[model samples]
Target: MKRILVSFAVLTSLAGVALADTHGAIAYSPSTSAIGWSYAHANRGDAETVARRNCDSSANDCRIAIWFRNGCGAVAVGHRGGWGSGWGYDGREAQRQAIRSCRKQTGSCRVIRWQCSENE
Candidate 1:
């Protein structure tokens, strides 16, 4: 009975850790040509804050593009004055989608950044 209780306690702790929400954020400033991203943060606010700070170092008027919990995000830039971003459960899929989104606005597009939260 004691061994069973110890096993249950360990499993419960593991479950709690697994359930904790992990966050990711991206920041960008089109005018200043700056982009920053962070993943696997403990909270949304921390993720955004860190991303914005990284952007602020290189650009002005930086803003959060997106935030995701237990997911992935990506940014893409096009050849002809276009940019796009997307989020999804898979990092590669998010990058592909972001490129696709940028291609919608311009002819050719390439991925700028791809990041995934730990949970994803």
Candidate 2:
């Protein structure tokens, strides 16, 4: 049951990331079992470009992705530039910290405008 739940949450998170439309935003939450994260690539174009932008932005924070595992959680909002470049932090701090770190890392990294709640 736990594995099934986790799998479902992970799948949901992946779907969200795949469908995300970049617009410069940051979001996050702490989870005991599972977590999620994502970034938007609006004007930036592709993941590489988005990663560069997120890293270049000076906002100091950006929304990543929505997540769910045991209870519920959000992805570690890395600096805008840390998206596709393999740069990012863990989901430890609150949503604000995640955004700050994400934005701090690169700057140009954009994220979804809003945080989406898990379906399950």
Cα TM-score per model = 0.85, 0.22
lDDT of each: 0.83, 0.36
Q: Write the per-residue lDDT of candidate 2 for residues 16-117, one digit (tens) a residue.
A: 977654432223221221222324334323423333344324434432333222122222323332532112222332334435545655664433222312
lDDT of 1 by residue, 22-93 (tens): 899888786765888888899999999988988867576788877778988888877776888888888988
- How far does residue 102 in candidate 1 sit from its true spot (Å)? 1.6
Q: Give the TM-score of candidate 1.
A: 0.85
- Every model's Cα RMSD, please? 2.2, 14.5
Instruction: After the best TM-score superposition of candidate 1, give how far the Cα of residue 66 lies from its true spot, in angstroms.
Output: 2.3
Model 2, stretches more than 4 Å misplaced?
1-68, 71-80, 84-95, 113-120
Clashing pairs in 1: none
